[model samples]
Target: MRVLVVSAPLVGHAFPLVPLAVALRDAGDDVLLATGGGALAAADAGLPVHDVAPGFDFGRIALRVLPRHPLVARAELAGTAGTRGAGLLFGALNDQLTDPVVALADRWRPDLVLHEPFAVAGAVAAARLDVPAVRQENSLFDGRELVRATGARLGATLRRHGLTELPPPAAAIAVAPPSVAVQDGWPMRYASYVGGGELPSWLREPGERPRVLVTRSTLTGPGDRGPMPAVVAAAAQVDAEFVLVRPDGRSARSLPGNVRVVDWIPLGEALPASAALVHHGGAGSALGALAAGLPQLATVGPGDRRHNAELVARRGAGLALRPRDVTAEALTRLLTDDGLRAAAGQVSREIAAMPAPADLVPRLAALV
Candidate 1:
């Protein structure tokens, strides 16, 4: 079977989707990952890639959707949870990929379309191509409402492709802890794959003290750069060492002693040695930390990050902090807390018990 795997063109989305695509590839199925600008990142990771929106920058659309500062953007979400912003951005991003994906699927004739849940373009393309479309869960919470919120717009777009309504996913690949699955699907074990990169030699050696990880979501573009400085300050207060992953050109400043910053490294490689992760409540970071059984201190932000943070708190695996409320003291305290580690272990065990990605291949093959 030939699989067309698509996702939002970002590191976070690519990281999670590739593991599943690799499983299929390893199982002797042909696989190609299609995205916008993220195709370059995927190609660097050694995946066969196709570009839909060749020059698409999600950050450009994100800045447009919430043009104000982070505080104003934060307040906008706080009001209606910014359903309008989410819908509009979803429409914009999907609009870029929809036609291109449909064209590629038409020429390529893929057997299945497995995609990040937010990439409505793939589902619509699959519907038009008459292939089984699978909605791969992108976050800890259900975002079906966002898709439904833009139903009129999405429906109108699909109409151009001769699709009257968007078809339901042939299968839904869910990696979130089952308790948090608002819309359950095939529960697959998360075979953690952050990127196709080699771990640095310095990272291989054990740190002098307990190491802490600080990161934010790949989707939080230029508009949300405010949190990085605060996160760096908080890490300075902690007695442990800090490993900051994927902090780009603009956000990589203000490093105190006992801190090491790397442009990119697989979380699977780094998490095993770390005591805990301090992150914006992105689904990738939260689930990745849980996969490693590392305690987490999540700073909640827009979209489902708030819900994901609440789940972290509810499960007792970590403390959830609001962006305005987070402090160096809280960072120090989370690093020192024993209970968080214990709670994290429980989440880890749950993830381990789920079916591994390879275990899911034969099952997905049957769908074809």
Candidate 2:
């Protein structure tokens, strides 16, 4: 089978598709990954790549909301109204890339098209070609519901665009643990959970001192421009050594003697030894920590971080704090809290026993 995978521009949005693409290739299916950014990373991983037109500028939207209030910004972006923002963002994105995507579909003529929810243009193109189109949602938010809810609010706009009829996805594959609830009343015939990806190489090792991994999600990149400084400051007060992953190297400033910053490290290499993690609570990061059984300190910035943080706290695996208000004292409390650590361990064990991506492939095959 020939499969064309459509992904968004950001690394966070694109990376979750890697394991599935690799699985498809290994199974003797031809897989072509089409993305706007992180094409090099995917190509380096041995997946065939096709560069599509650039998607939306959510980074600009994030910058607009970060400094003023991370929580409110996140709420606005992830809430029902924010779904409209997503639709507008992708509608403009689709408008920009429609011609190229249509051309690609015409040329590639794959058996199926798998896409990130934000890459709506791929969905439209697949429809135009009359091929099966499946959406892969890797984050905590529900895209089908978000889009459906947004469509209700933008009924006139949707009607104006002749989108009154909802397009049923061939499948919606969610990459979350089974512990997470799949939304009720969604079209289950086409919607299923596939679970999260494997640990990166770095988290597999055992270390002496308790390690604390700090990152601002893959999308935040490595720039002093994000909330890392606050994490560094808070981490300085803890007993553990910090393994900081700033792949972009934009955030290398005066560092504490105990803090070590690297451009990149496999999360699997670091998480096993780490007693706790501090992150912006992207779904991948949160699930990585859960897989490792590490307690978390979530300094939620934007997007699904707030919801992920709430899940973390509800699961009793960690504490959630606002980026603006995070302090060394708070970090120390979460790291040293025994009950939280034990609870995190329980959650981790639960995640570890769940099915991996390898197990999800057949289910995905059934979807196709």
Candidate 3:
């Protein structure tokens, strides 16, 4: 079968599709990934790639807007009502949503289309081509409140184009653990939990001292908000060595004595050594910690971060703090607290026992 995978320009949106694409190729299906320039380099290595248009550089836009329009920053960091505003602000910058993907569908027609949830253009293109489009959600946009918050603006855009009445696609894949409960009302009939890519080579097993992992989401570009200095301070207070991974060089600034920075370290490699994780609470990062049985200190900033943090705290696996309150004292407490650590380990074991994506891939394949 020939599958066309449509991804957004952002790394967060594009990277999750990589493992699925590789899986499809291994299964003897032809997979072609379509996105803008943002993920072209990664796709070029092996996966077939087709550029939809010039990618949107959200980092540059954030730097310009975050200071003056705090709502823009909130939208960029917190996954709240602000995302609708950001989408509206940036949507006018490119018309690719309606044009490029539709044009491409005309040329490389495939049996099915796989798309990121935020990649509205790709979904529309699949609809236009009259092919089966499978929508993939990479984050925690699950409950009714979150759905209403994030989808309001995009829904309006579709309505304006006379596309409001269309039913949702054939399937929706959740790339997270099933423990992360989603609203039952979502349109998806099928949901699968897929973890992130394999672990990197540099990580070591846990030692005598507690180990903590610090990372931001890969989608948040270099200029995106991160409390690196505070991360360093927190590591110092906990007496833990910090292994920081920022895939896009977002956190490459001056480091403290106890902190080690890497451009990209696989979570699989880093999680086993980690007693606790300090992160921006992206779904992938949160699930990575859960899969590893590590507790989390979620310092949430933007979309779904707050929700993911709430889940962690509610489950008793960790503490969730706002960016401003993520102090060294809090970090120390999270790292040393026995109850929270124990809860995290328990949750991790639960997550590990759940069905892996390899099992679900064939189920999805059967749908086609």
RMSD of each: 3.0, 5.4, 4.6
Instruction: Summarize candidate 1's per-residue lDDT along 151-262 as a digit string, tens digits.
Output: 4457668888888877788888778877544556888876645655678876666688888887866665432442455667666676888877777666567678877887
Cα TM-score per model: 0.89, 0.79, 0.80
TM-score of 3: 0.80
lDDT of 2 by residue, 228-305 (tens): 667666666767677777623544567777787765555656666677888876777777677667888776544456
User: Per lDDT, what order, best first?
Assistant: 1, 2, 3
lDDT of 3 at 280: 80
List, residue by residue over 1-368, the lDDT tens digit for candidate 3: 77888776666667667766777778888888888656665564478888776745756555654567666555555556444544543443223454777777778887778877666566666677777777766565552233233344456555654576334667767644455555332222122223334454546677557767777755645324555556765555667777776633434556666777665555666667677888887666676677677788886566557777888888888888876687878888877889887887887766666555455567567767
Candidate 1 wrong stretches, greater than 4 Å: 63-84, 150-152, 220-223, 248-254
Q: Who is ahead in TM-score, 1 or 3?
A: 1
Could you say which candidate leads in lDDT?
1
Better of 1 and 2 by lDDT: 1
Q: What are the runs in model 2 whose C-alpha is more than 4 Å off?
A: 54-84, 149-166, 178-206, 220-227, 247-251
- How good is model 2 by TM-score? 0.79
